[model samples]
Target: MKAIVCHELNGPAALRLEDIPEPSPAAGQVRLRVRACGVNFADSLITRGQYQVQPEPPFSPGFEVAGDVLELGEGVTEFAVGDRVIALTLHGGYAEQAVVNVNRCVAIPPAMPYQHGAAFPVVFGTSHIALWHRARLQAGETLVVHGASGGVGLTAVAIGKQLGATVIATASSPEKLDIARQHGADHLINTSHDDIRLRIKELTEERGADVIYDPVGGELFNASLRAIAFEGRILVIGFAGGTVPQIPANHLLVKNVDVIGLNWPAYAERHPTVMTESFRILLDWYLAGAIQPYVSEIYPLEEAVDALHQVVSRKSTGKVVITVGD
Candidate 1:
């Protein structure tokens, strides 16, 4: 099997394509003939040993994959061979074959393409759980999504609108803002030049946003703190901006603001029921055509490094997928 292997804790540039031995399924796991893999910003972080669950050196960085099941591990009866599924591998997805725990795998909808299946899990799941389960976003509330054009941010915009909240999207450029608008954002903020705090104040008649979904931390998170409603809930998705902002407890006390940190993958280990229910609802919405992944680019497995670079550099919109087998 061909795989992109990282021998040391460098960045994406250090990842190299090489022929590696095929992986086999263990008990409670299944071997997949990987068709496609989702390239996430976390893929870049894991390469540099910055992710939450860092595998040792000489590991692949892909987290989510979609493919056909070649064999089911012992004690796995939920799925049979040849079932099409999308799985959260945590790592080892940047290869022609991968072994993933059956618990982390969800059967892909029949109508969904391999690429869509690969792109769906991480971003959509993160945003859905963050807004619906964690934040408890309500209809008629004002929701703001920072980095609204990126992978997870785009999903937050769609989910916020689907939940009936008026969405205000913030991105670094007009082009990115336009993409967010097409995905159902009610208002747009060009963070490259606009005053985010003042804009939210103006847009909401000074009431501020009811929920702020921030995947880009740094200064944008600081702005969200000031622009939030009195009882607003802020969901901290990630620090894609490279700097994790320090939260001042005074701000939380004054406004009754709730800063919630979401580790989406934790659900798989600690709260499996929540993950299962979330996936059921998400798959239902997908079949109803209510939400769809916006895959901006697809790269061959040989160019997986370039794919990771595209996401790490924040140059691509929506999801970037790496197709494995033809």
Candidate 2:
């Protein structure tokens, strides 16, 4: 099997494409002939040893994958060989083959392509669980999505619209804002020029946004603290903007605000039911054509480092996928 292996904890530039031994599935796990892998900003973090769960050196950095079940491990009865499926692995997705726990695997909808299946889980799952389950976003509320043109951000915009909220999208450029608009954002805020806090207030008629979905956590998060409506919930998705904001308890006290931090992957381990239910709803929406992944770029497995760099540099919109085989 060919895999992109990271021999050091430096960055994506240090990754090497090499031939690796094929892995077999353990009990309760299934071996997959990986067709595609999703490239995430976290993939870059894991390479730098900055992610929450860091495997040792000499490992792969991919997290989600879609492929065929080549062999099923002992005790796995829900899936069979040749079944099309998507699996969430901690690592090793940037390879021709990956072994995944059956519990983390889901059947890919017949209509969904392998690239979409690979791209679906992380971004869509994160936004759906964050807005629907965690924030309890209401239908008539005003929702604001920061970094709205990026992977998870775009999904947040789409999901917010599907949930009936008026979504205000913020991005660094007009082109990015345009992409967000096409994805269903009701209002656009160009972070390059507009004042986010003022814009939200203006868009909401001084009431401020009822829910703020924040993925870029530096200055934008500070703006969210000011723009959120009273009793509003702010979902902290990530710090993609390169700076982690320090929250002031005074702001929360004054506005009765709730700053909720969401680690979407935690649901897979601590609350499997939540993840399963979220995926079920997302896949249903996909099959119904209500929501679809906007895969911006697809790179071959040999250029896995370049794929990771595209995401790490924040140069690509929506999802970037790495194809393992034809």
Candidate 3:
């Protein structure tokens, strides 16, 4: 199997492609002939040794994949060989074949393509957990999503609208804002050209947004607090803006707002049943054509470095994937 191996602590450009031995499933894992691998911002961080869960040097850097099961590990009865599946592997998905825990794998919808299934788990899971569970977003309420053109951002926008919220999407460019509009965002705000706080307030008649889905923390996170409504819930999804913002307690206290932190991986580990149920709902929406996992570009497995670089550059309108095999 050929995999993208990171032997040193460098960025995506330092990732190397080389032939590696295929992995076999353990007692609770299954081996997959990887069809596509999803590249994420975490993949870029892991390659640069900046992510929280850093595997040692000389490890593959992919978090999610979709493929056909090659062989089932012992004690695995829910899946079988040749079944198309998507799994949330911690790493080692940017290759021809990989091993993943059975619990982390879910049967992809029959109508979904391999590329979408590969891209679904992380972003969709995050959006579902953040909006439905953490924030408890309500129907007819106004929701604002920052970085609304990125993978998880777009998912949040779509899910917000699906759940009956008047979705307001924010991006830095008009093109990116257009992407969010096409994905069901009821309103769009280009942060570069307009004042997010002013626009959000203007759109909602100064009541502010009922829920703010902020994955790109930093200055933007701080400003979002100003646009939050009374009793508003701000879901903190990530720190993609290169800086993590510090929360001032006074702001929350004055507005009677809540800042909810959404740690998707930790939540999945701590609440297995909830994770499974969340994915099931996402799959249900996907099968009904209620949601679509957008893949802006697909690169071959050997081009994993370029794929990660694209994601790191923050230029992708949707998810970027690696085509591992047929």
Model 1's alpha-carbon lDDT is 0.95
Number of clashes in every candidate structure?
0, 0, 0
Model 3 C-alpha lDDT versus the unseen true structure: 0.90
lDDT string, candidate 3, 21-92, tens digits: 889888989999999999899998888888777898899989999999999999999998999999888889
Question: Can you write out model 2's per-residue Cα lDDT over 1-326, one digit (the tens) per residue?
Answer: 89999999999999999999999999999999999999999999999999999899999989999999999899999998999999999899999999999999999988999999999999999999999999999899999999899999999999999999999999999999999999999999999989889999999999999999999999999999999999999999999999999999999999999999999999999999999999999988998999999999999999999998888788999999999978
Count residue pairs with overlapping backbones in model 2: 0
Candidates 2 and 3, the one with greater TM-score: 2
Query: Residue 74 in model 1: shift from native, Å?
Result: 0.8
Q: List lDDT for all candidates, in order.
A: 0.95, 0.95, 0.90
Score every model by TM-score: 0.99, 0.99, 0.98
Off by over 4 Å in 1: none
Question: Which residue segments of model 3 deviate by more than 4 Å?
Answer: none
Q: Least accurate stretch of 10 residues (summed lDDT) in model 3?
A: 261-270
